[model samples]
Target chain A: MSRASWQAFREGAYHTLPLILGAIPFGIIFGTLGPASGLSVEATLLMSLLVFAGSAQFIALGLVATGTPVGLIIAVTFVVNLRHLLYSITLMPSVCHLPLNWRLTMAFWLTDETFAVAVSRMAPEHRTQFHWYYLGSALAMYGNWQLCTLLGVTAGQWIPGIENWGLDVAMAVTFIGIVVPQIKTRPKLLCAISACCLSLLWHDWPHHTGLIAAAIAAVVLALTAETMGQKKETSLKTGSKTT
Target chain B: MTEFILIVGMLAATYFVRLLPFALADRMRLPAILENALQYVPIAVLSAIIAPAVCLPEGYFWIDWKNPYLMAGLVSVIAAAIGRNLVITIFAGMATALSIKFLIV
Candidate 1:
């Protein structure tokens, strides 16, 4: 490989290793649960490939297990994945200059992990290359997900003690690790707390609509807190001039 | 026929939701309030998933010494917040959860 290509490949590999490791147990759990959830092997594998989202796919699987109506399941999945809209919005300005094929390919691989790594590392100047890096990270995650799901499906019941293995906590831990550092302000803290409370209160809502509502509530709360903070700061500055 | 239609509809709906913001951002200038709202999206979505998973273990709201998952999750959150390392935090959380499950239940 050329020097730049090698660097990109290496960067992608290094960035994706942790995500793959985190995803393995998750994939295995999904595989183990798929049959019990009444999903055929082909359907399970297809869902993994097509959805490629860990949490939302699990939520969909749970709904499917309960024999939810097809329309409700589809609607819930759509709502559960609404956060991806935010992701695409954040990434578009950075990746717009890329070729159409590359843009679409990167879009296909866009998940929380890949987007996190890509957005965090993107520089203001070399934003064009952000898509390449995103492609590398996302493609690596995609490969791991496919392989792990294949392994899980083939092994099936033979893959013992997956629940006991504590793989489910991996995603939560990873999320907390990613999000805690970013909660550097009061408004962000309020957003987190309010969202958690709202979701808990509305957990029984059908189609997981409570989640979407909680997300909306958090954004509103944060915006309000931010505006109030700004007003206070402005008032303080004006009062200091009189004093 | 129903299953096929369901899958197609799901694919369309998911893609529409994912694409909507990008299309809007391209066509119109978003207000500052909307931009700030976007900033809270990740945390809100994440907490929405995490809270119920941790708080409701038996399909109901039950919190007590018997529930190790919640205890472990709390510890895991604290550790992650303080440690800020993905591998360490995950390992700590998993280990705590497993140990608690085995010991308590």
Candidate 2:
């Protein structure tokens, strides 16, 4: 590869290294849990390949293991992943100039980690290279995930103290790392608090439907708060002008 | 046969959900209300996952003060809020939880 391409790859790898580290334990947990939940080796690997989502896949496995209806499992997965819609929207302008093939390829790898890193680095002027950087980050993450899962599946049975590793805490820590930085406004804070409360209250709902309810509640609360804030701003401006 | 059918149906449904937004996003101009709603989707979904995991570790409404996950999560939050590196936050939280779990649980 040319020096520029190699540099791009190195930069992308450096940017995404933290995400890969965080994802390792997550991938191991999923790999171990998949087989323990009655999924065959093929099925477990296929899930990592197709679904490619850590939390959603775990929820789906639980539902499937519990013999929840297939329809419900699919629906819940869709709801849980609805945030990807927002990611795509935010990324659309940056990626619109790419060819359809490249766009589609990049879309397949747009996980939460890639989205966080890519969005933070995206510049309005250098929109074109955003896809290249995105692809590089995605490739690194995807490669690491596959390797980690392979190790987890092969040695998972004999890994005596794997469960004691506290890898599960990584997910929560990663989310806190991402979310706390973005909670700079009152509306965002309200939305987060409201969603957490609603989720806890509705935790007993079947088929993981409580998550959907929480998401809807947060969206409604945030939108209402934003609308009210805008109206108050307008009223203040009008009153000041009249005075 | 049933399992195969279910898997196929799920794959199709998932693809459809993913494709629907991309297909319609260009053709249909989303209204202001809908735009506003989309803004909270991430926080909402994240809270849905995190809150339950922390608040209900025993798979019920039982709250335990000695819960390592909860304590570690709180630490992680504080660390993140202070703008610590992501790796450091995760390591601190995970190590704390593992030590607590081993010592206590």
Candidate 3:
């Protein structure tokens, strides 16, 4: 890679350093639970490497523990990860300048945490080299996931019930940090509030469909709020002009 | 064999969902309304994701006097809202939750 690309990559990785804390317990929990659920270490690692979706992986682990059919497990995971589609959509415009191969690799690596970091760092001056930064964050997250999962699979045996130690609560809190700064508008706040309430209400929904429902509700609500605000502005202007 | 199939299928489906629209982003002209709504996607999905993690840490819904998640999460959210600091929010949240869990369980 060029020196510029290399620098961008390092910057990306460095910025992602703090977010890695949130992913650590999550990856370790998945690692520990995978083996405990009767999955072989190899299969667990393969799933973490290839699938790389924590929510879906955890859901799969639960289903596997219950002896749910493989087909059903995949189906459930598909539904659970449909939110990634929204993620992809949100990231598209920012990533559209890259080559096809780079885009493909990025799409594969773009998780919630990486997306948060990458999007925030995409200032106008950095647009040309941002792909390098994206790669940096993506690879850092990938490496962390792999190493943490390995630790969980191997050393996790010595630490009994470590998955339940509430360490993963840090991830939820980190998520709040990611959301809090972006909520400058009333509609955005309401979007978060409504999504939070709906997700709780739909927590028990089958196959993680409730998450999608809540996300869709927030998007729709935000759209309505923005459009209505626009219309009201226009109507007030016309009314004053007529008066 | 079943696990293999599960992994492969999920890999294919998940990757497809991620790769397709991204590839199509340049070629497509999304409607303005859809574009506007996309702005809310990340925070909405994130907020939604957070709800279950705190409210149903054990994969079941429970929010009451006994659960530390709700209380701890509220603490973390307040910290995030006030401090806007990732490290502080995570550490404070985890510390609060762990302390409560330690005290209770």
Candidate 4:
């Protein structure tokens, strides 16, 4: 409520503007796919309101369309969102000193975009007002998502066969955008390759179990690859010292 | 009723995964191996999702060049690697898919 907090909040929201723009199509695509995938408008809106995790929601939609069990869907949602645990760990230093209510609200609002904007803008001295700036970014993204979902839902109803038009390519491509940049190292690249290939091989598995299996396999493989690389480097250094 | 339960379950799963870490942050000491594993979860899960959606767009093995999703997905991957921009990657993929769908195949 103070002037400085208000200014920080505005700056946080402003810095997040580009990310908000990137989310527009993504949000609309979710909205349209919800109804098309046999979800009621109420349920779709409520998912956006409550779950609020885009990738998980998209995966849920795909599973729901295939009549997968709700338990499996929720499990997949949990696995897909495990990355949030890492994000919270990284931001813990910045937010640990805050009150319970502030931390809880901030945790709920913590999306990929807000994390990027908040982490980059946070300073040790500005710790007190940083949550306000985070609030700005979170609120901006939250509002933008809800608005885009509404538009897509309305458009889905108005546009005939829009769902059949393969709007899911948006999600596929978006996933590509997300995964490609993160594949900088050999371990990450192999992880992605293994997951991609395994999912395809097990595509017909019941209950969408293939996805979970593939994800688990990829993570384990990456961890092993990383450990092996570390060992090789250490041994090489030791060998040079002895010689 | 089923939908309601599912949504509540998802809400609980997502919210708790996020909130529990913060509440327990003081006592939490994630092992280095666990941290490394967690880092790869996003890429692995997302790649799992993307591979099926693109490679089997029609719910079968459609790896042909004419498969619009496959072509566009490749384009998007290139765009993402080269441009490293979300909007451009999405636009490039969308443009390629739409063109191939309407014009070529």
Best by TM-score: 3
Chain A vs. native, model 2, TM-score: 0.82
Question: What is the C-alpha lDDT profile of model 4 across A85-191, one tens digit per residue?
Answer: 65677666677777788888988877877876676654688888988999999999899888888888987568766656666687688768777988889999999
DockQ of candidate 2 compared with the true complex: 0.49
What digit string (tens of lDDT, one per residue) describes model 2 on residues A155-215? 8768866855667777777766777677778888888889889989998886567867886
Inter-residue clash pairs, candidate 3:
none
Residue B59: error of model 4 in Å? 3.4
Please say which candidate is ahead in TM-score: 2 or 3.
3
Total clashing residue pairs per candidate? Answer: 0, 0, 0, 0
Q: TM-score each candidate.
A: 0.87, 0.84, 0.94, 0.76
TM-score: which is higher, 1 or 4?
Answer: 1
lDDT of 1 by residue, B13-48 (tens): 666765555444444555655655666777777777
Alpha-carbon local distance difference test for all models = 0.72, 0.72, 0.86, 0.82
- Please estimate how well model 3 matches the true structure, expressed as its whole-model Cα lDDT: 0.86
* Candidate 3 chain A weakest ten by summed lDDT: A115-124
Stretches of model 1 off by over 4 angstroms after superposition: A1-13, A66-69, A97-100, A164-166, B1-9, B23-28
Error of 1 at B37 (Å): 3.1
Please give the RMSD to the true structure for each candidate, in Å.
2.8, 3.2, 1.8, 4.2
Please provide, for model 3 over A43-149, each residue's C-alpha lDDT reduced to its tens digit, 9 standing for 90 to 100: 99999899988878888898899999988887887788788888888777777777888888898987888888887765679888889999999999999999999
